[model samples]
Target chain A: MLQIKNLKATIDGKEILKGINLEVKAGEVHAIMGPNGSGKSTLASVLSGKPGYEVTGGEVIFEGKNLLDFSPEDRAREGIFLAFQYPVEIPGVSTTNFMKTSLNEIRKYRGLEPISSVEFLKLMKAKAKLVELDMAMTSRAVNVGFSGGEKKRNEIFQLAMMEPKLSVLDETDSGLDIDALRIVSEGVNKVRNSKNAFVVITHYQRLLNYIVPDYVHVLSDGQIVTSGGKELAYKLEEMGYDWVTNND
Target chain B: MAELKDKIIEKYTSTENLNNGEPVEIKHIRDKAKEYFRTFGFPNRKMEDWKFFDSKPIITNDFKLVTEKQEIEKSVLNNFLIQDLKANLIVLINGEYSKENSQIITERKNLFIGSLKEGMKTKPYILGKYFAKYADYNADGFTALNTAFAPDGAFIYIPKGNLLKDPVIILNILDSRKSKVLGQPRNIIIAEANSDVHIIEEYYSIGENDVFSNVVTEIHTDENANVQYYKIQNEEANAFHVGTTQVFQERNSIFTSITLSWGGSVTRNNLNSYMNSEGIECNFKGLYFLTGKQHVDNHTLADHANPNCNSNELYKGILADESNGVFNGKIMVRQDAQKTNAYQMNKNILLSDTASINSKPQLEIFADDVKCSHGATTGQIDKEQLFYLKARGIGEKEGKKLLIFAFANEIIEDIEVPELKEYLVNRLNEKLEKL
Candidate 1:
């Protein structure tokens, strides 16, 4: 469902993602583990079409369409979601309103009728229980004055709401506790199906335990060094990426 | 004043003659104002109050004083109606009073509202006593010029202990039938002790014509009286607006003034609040949203002359396109005004690189025991917040709108009037749609 060919990106004229090529089919969870300065987040940002990032070379194809030709909204409409490492705090905009606008915008782009308010509220209520989000939190401004765990949980809640085809989780487990990690992973697992996929990017193997990816890849200097099965995660966690990369 | 007299009598001649209203003219006061204007003529660039906003354009142009001789159509006044509210509408077409579209409810007691022509005979004593009492006639040149042509104005007086449940809305329409026209719409409002009233002055234009408006309003709040004054200026993009609002609060009185400026080519608004006695309080709030090539300059002053007085001023501006904004706020606490609590804050957001804002908050305090603080900030939209919204599938346009609205919600929540609050929010939403 996704293909990357020699993706080379830079920020402020400095090369970040040197060369990357990957392909993932449906119903697959791909875990990417890297050390500091491995260009993990850079890969996610370039894939999401963020401004100020120049793609010097290569192209990304998603669902048989050139992804780089689409605007950020168009990319989102085509079911491409990026969970930011650091969530933003938007004041004076309620989470419910934000979610509704986003959902309707995507629906309109797809030429589909907007979900009724009653149905939307019902969906929000049922999804909130997945991550154990409080109803009061949904009524307040989007992520304003929320704790670190709540922001990540809120991101997952949105992931569930949008139901994107390919979800890119970037450092979603950094600031979460054990219980929050469990809840967030559970929410992601609930949305996983035979036709959807997840690209889990992290610096640790802790989150991989709950989600249990089908493939594990190590990224170093903007390039994946090796690929293996689920047991490679435990091996990397035990010996660290430095040992593996040095041995290689 | 000599310069003004020479310019007005020689360069710009009045084409229309004055109306024969009761033949009761205050030549003595007029002469005194002229003499004062001679000493305090139009301010140059050196003056502190008129530093950023120069008055050279108004002085150099030959703007003839208008009268009610021109034909005015009813279609011009149709768009200025606040159709939803229970209001007493008073429309001024081309700086002249329009009685056909105005009506005053007589159910209220000890209340007097009429044009300057009617007030000349009905409430002469009240008008004579407090006509230009608190206005700094020598400081502003156009204010003196407005006083020289005081026939085209409004007079409002509410007696002690009277409450006006309905708002009295005054619409000043600057319709330029001839060449570039200039209007001087002056208003005098006096509320006695324990009286409560709300006044809203709206400035607008009908057609696509260039006009200049020079306005002044003198307000007096008696002891323990409360007044809510709101000024809404939505002139045409081809117009220039320069106005001054002077307010005097007595002991234990409360006065709140809010100005919303959305349109005009070049606009300068000056507001001053003087707390003359102890236990008095004042709140001055302003919001200006500018787009295109518009320039908005706001200068305000809060003078605390007595002890135990409090003053708060907050102004916010959102600039888009190539718009420029300037805000200068001055607060003074005299030696006797101890225990004064004064706060001032100015915040701005420049959406485009060409958009700019210059803000300066000044405070002069002679008293030692006072709490005063000031701050100013100018920046673009927060990218982190934008990313957060986008992560949730909200598009860029909707995300930016949410941030801008959130930036303005702090000030809108401060409005005490429910109807006005809703109206402001709706107007804000409409303007955001264009952005």
Candidate 2:
């Protein structure tokens, strides 16, 4: 579903992602773990088409389409979703209205008519139940005065609503508690299907326990140092990234 | 300079609304106003109060004063109607009230709802006491011009201990289609002790030629009274507008003013509130949405003269294209206002690189036990907020429109008038579609 070849990106004069090559297939999950300043978040940011990140070399292909050629919005319409680490607080935009606009835009991109408000409400109610998000929270401004756990859950709720072909979760578990982690992971597990893929980017193996990955890749500096099965996550958690990268 | 100042006499005296049958009290006030204008004609950019605004374009034009009232087209009147609004409508055409066009449904005996001319003739005692009482005509050139030359405007007097169930909508329309007409309307609203009322003053013009409207409204909220005033200026793109609203609040009174500027070439709005006694709450909120080459300047002052008073001011602007905006908010906490609380905020968004905004906050606090804070911010649409919307599949254009709409909607969200709120949101969407 996704492929990156020699992806080299730089924010300023310094290079962040030196050379990254990763292949993500349908119906599989990939977990990327790294220590501080190891380019883990940089890989996620580069894949999602954020501005200010210059692609000095190489390309990214999603669903056989050149992803770098599309804008951030077009990438999203093409079924690429990025769950932000910190959800932005739009002062006057209600979450329900935001969801409706996003869903209709994606539908419009797919040559479909806009969804009726009644049908949209039904869809919203069902998705809110799946993620255990309060229905009242959807009526308020997006992420305004929301708790940390609710913000993370809202991200999962949106992911469920979009049903994207590929989702990159960037540090979504950083501010969540144990209960919130389980709820978000379970919501992700329920939304996963045979034709979708997930790239879970985190620092600890605790999140991997809930949503087990098909393969674990430890990123160091810029390149992937090791790729192994789920046990590699527990090993890295037991002995830090120093133990893994030093052995590399 | 002499030629420019001498031309003001011929410009206004040419009108046929003479002093014949005018009250002696009204004549004295006009003469006093004329003397003030003789000394200081039109405000220039050199004055401290008019430093940012240059009145040359407005004062140099040879605008003929509106001599007679003209019939307003039914279509134009229909376009200004609020949907599902249940309120009293007062139609003022070319500065004078038209009873045939207005719908005053209230049959209360004590309520005197009519024109300023009628108020001067019929209720001399009431009109003489409150007219030109609060608005400082000796200082402002436009106020003097309006006082010396204004023919008529809506005058509402609610007697003591009465709560008006229906709001009053003063529809002021200028029929400048005939010529380059100028309109100056003076309005006075008095809510007696313990009375409450809400009024909306809307300015509309149907003409392609130049229309200049100089308007002044004075509101006096007596002890324990309440008042809510709304001023909406939506006229032709080339029209020039200068309006002043002065409010006086007594003990245990409440006053709220909302001013919305949607269309104009050059518009200036001044709103001032004086809290005279304790336990008074005053709120002044304004919003301006400008496109093309439109310009709007808003100045506000909240004076806390007594102890235990609260005042708040929030002004927001969205300037697109080459439009320019200016905001100046002043708050004064007198020494006697020991327990006063005042807050002021001015926020602006410049959509285009050429669009600009100048905002300044002036706070003069003399009381040590008062709480006051003021802030001003001017920037483009938040980049992070825009990108977040775009990343959710909304296109970049749509995302920007959404952010701009949300930014302006924050000010409109606090309106307590349901019908006006609905109408404004629809009108705002219509403008945002082009942006």
Candidate 3:
């Protein structure tokens, strides 16, 4: 479903991702874990085509298409969704309106008719409940004055709404409490299917307990130093990065 | 300076019946205003008040100051009327009242809604007391020029203890079909004690030629009176507009002014309010959405002369292309005006690289028990916000348009009238398409 070949990225003349390669098939979940400043977020940003991040030498292929040729907005319309680490507060734009705009945009790109108002409201109500979001929250400005947990849940709501081909959860569990983590992870699990894939990026093994990954990879100093199954997550969490790197 | 001034004086003295049926007092007042304009000439960039506004374009254009009244069909105005508004309509063709075009649907015994020229003859006492009273002609050149001409304009008076249910809509249309036309319209609105009223002034340029509208409005609110004033400027791209609205608030009175500037080549607005008595509330709100080479400047002042008064001012702008936007808001709290509260804020968004915005807030406080705060900000649309929208599958252009509309919606949401608000929302959407 997604392929990264020799992905070398830089920001402000400093290379962040150094020759990292990864691949994931449909119906599978991959978890990328790393310590602080190990290019975990940079990888997600590069995959989503964020501005200001220069891909020095790399090519990202998503569903047989060269993703680098598309703009950030185009990437989203092509079913590449990146749940931001920190969702920005946009005043005066209701969350429902935001959802409507993006849904119609994606539909247009896919040669589908725009969603009707009745269907939109029904979809919003259904998806909003998956994350336990209040109907009132959708009427307020997007992310304005939202709590940290509410923001995370809102991100999951968007993930459910878009139903993208490849979803990158970048640090979605960082600021969440135990309850919020369970809810957010459970929401992701409900949306998981054999036709779609998710790449969970996190700094800890706590979120993995809820949404188990098919494979686990440890990223250190801008490269994937070790790759293994779910046992790798338990070993790294038990012995720490020092033991994991020394053993590798 | 000499050329325009001499020509105006030549025409002011030689024109027959310019003062026909006009009171002797009004004629003397006109002469004084003309003399004042002659001395000050036109406001240049050298003057502090006119530092950011340049009147050179208006002076060099040689627009005909004396525009003849043009006969326009009623259907010609159908395109500009508010869709669902039911109000007393007063139409002015080139600054003169057109009885054939205006409609007065609501009338009371003590209420007066008609032209200033007729109001002066019918209610001389009211006109004699309120006309040429609050607005300053001595310091402002355009005010002086407008006062000198003081042509026919919309005049409305609400009697004491009466609530005006229907708002008065004044359509000031500039007919520049044949040549450059300059209009000077003076408006006076007096709300007696405990009266409430709403007035809307909408300006439009009908032709492609150069059109200039120099307008001055004087309003007086007696004790406990409430007045809502709205100005919707949808002029042509080749239009130049200078408007001055002076308001006086008595004890326990409330006055609110909102301006929406959507057109013109160069536009400058001056809105001032004097809280002369205790416990007055004053508000000034404006929004300007400009594209192309449009330039707009808004200057406002809130003077608190008595105790226990409050004034709040907020103005926002969205500038696209190489347009320019400017704002200067002054808050003055006199020594005797204790416990006064004054707040001011101005914000702007520049869509293109060349678009410019300038804002300055001035506060002078001599009262020890006063509170005042002001803030200003100018920048491009927030990148993080825009990216968030784009990441949701919305296209770049659609996201940008939405953000711009939301930015300007903060001002439009404060409109008190429902139909007007709906109309403005549609107008804003149309303007955003071009941006």
Candidate 4:
């Protein structure tokens, strides 16, 4: 589903992702674990085509197309979703309206008719139930004055709404408690299917217990030093990242 | 400068028969206003109050003062009124109220709605008590001009303890199809004790020729009365408008004013409210969206005279192309006005680098026990907000339009009238699309 060949990225003359390479097939969930300042978030940002990041000498291919040539919005229309580490608060824009606009825009790019109001409401209700989001929260401004757990849940709600082909969860478990983590992971697990893929990035192994990944990659000093299975996360959690970084 | 003044004087002298049976008090006020205008001529950039707003383009043109009312077709008048609005409609053609175009509910005994001229002839005693009382002619050149040439406008009076069921919409239409004209519509609204009323005033020009509309509205609210006033200016691009709204609030009265400026080449609004007694509340909100070479200036003042009064002010502006905007808001708390709470905020978004805004929020407090705060901010649309929207598959243009609409929606949502709020929202969307 996605391929990153010798991904070399930099910001302000400082290299962040140093020749990182990764590959993912359809229906597989990958977890990229690292300590602080290990360039995990940079990989997600580069995949999402954020501005001010210079791709020094690498290429990213998504679904048989060169992703680097597309703009951020075009990449979104092409089914690339990046759940932000910190969700933006857009005042005066209701979450319902925001989702409607985004869904319609993506549909328009794919030559689909706009959804009817009645159908849109039904869809909203069905998807919101998956994440346990309050109906009142959808009518209020998007993420304005929302709690940290609510924002994270809202991100999952959007993921359910968009149904993107490739979803990158960047530090989605940062500020969540145990209950919130369970609910959020349940939302992600429910939306998983054979046609999609997920790149879960986290600093800890707690989120993996709920939405278990097929493969685990330990990122250290801007490179993926080790790759293993689900048990590797528990091993790293018990011993710590130094077990791999010290030997490397 | 002298040529425009000479033209006004000539027109005033030639139209003597227009006010043949005017009351003696009214004639005296007119003469005094004329004298004041002659002494000061037109306000210049040299004056501190008129520094940012230059009056050169407005006063340089040789505009003929409209003395006779222009005939307008009923179909043309219906286009300006809100469709399906169940409110009393008062239409003014060329600054003169058209009785044939107005609809007033006579079943309400305490309600009085008619032309100002008719009100002067029928109830001159009541008109004389509040006319030119709140708007000081000596303070503003435009106020003096409107007073001297004031002939006819809308007059709304509600007796004590009467709550109006329907809103009153006053539509002022300027027909400059024949010549370059000047229309001054002077309005007075009086709400008796314990009464409630809502008013919506709008300006519309029918022609593409140069038209100057100078309007003054004075509102007097008695004890415990509630009033909501809205002023909407969406005239032709060749039009110029200078509007002054002065409100006086008695003990425990509540007053709210919303000013929306969407069109016109040069627009200036002076909105002032005076809280005379304790426990009074006042709110002043404004929104302006300008493009092309348009210029809009807003000056607002909230004067707290007694203890335990509160006032809030918020004004937002969106400037694109080469448009220019200015916002100057002042809140004053007198020495005896202890426990007064006042807040003022002004925000502007500039779309193009050539677009400019001058925002100034001032607070003057003589009472040490008062709580007062003021803020002014001017900047371009936030890049992060824009990118957030764009990253969701929305285009740059649509993203910008959405953000700008959201910025202005904060004030638009506060409108008490549902229909008017919806109307302004549509108008704002249409304005933002052209940008």
Full-model lDDT for every candidate: 0.82, 0.88, 0.90, 0.89
Please, what are the lDDT tens digits per residue for candidate 3 over residues B82-145? 9979999999877889898899988889799999999988998878777788987897778998
Tell me how each candidate scores on DockQ against the true complex.
0.52, 0.81, 0.81, 0.74
lDDT of 2 at B272: 94
Q: Per lDDT, what order, best first?
A: 3, 4, 2, 1
**Candidate with more favorable, higher lDDT: 2 or 4:** 4
Error of 1 at B392 (Å): 4.5
* CA lDDT, candidate 1, residue A155: 87
RMSD of 4: 1.5
Instruction: Give the per-residue lDDT digits (tens) of candidate 1, residues A1-248.
Output: 99988999988998888788888889999998899888899888887877889999988999999999987778888999898788777778888988898899888888889989999999999989877788788999888898889999988988888999999999999989999899889989998999999999999999999999999988888788888998989999999988767865
- Clash pairs, candidate 1, are B1-B38
On DockQ, the stronger of 1 and 2 is: 2
Off by over 4 Å in 2: B1-5, B11-20
Model 1, CA-based lDDT: 0.82
Candidate 3 segments whose C-alpha is farther than 4 A from its true place: none
- What TM-score does model 2 achieve against the real structure? 0.97
lDDT of 3 at A17: 98
Query: What lDDT tens digits, residue by residue, belong to model 4 across residues A85-193?
Result: 9989999999998889889888999999988999999999999999888889999999999988999999999989999999999999999999999999999999999
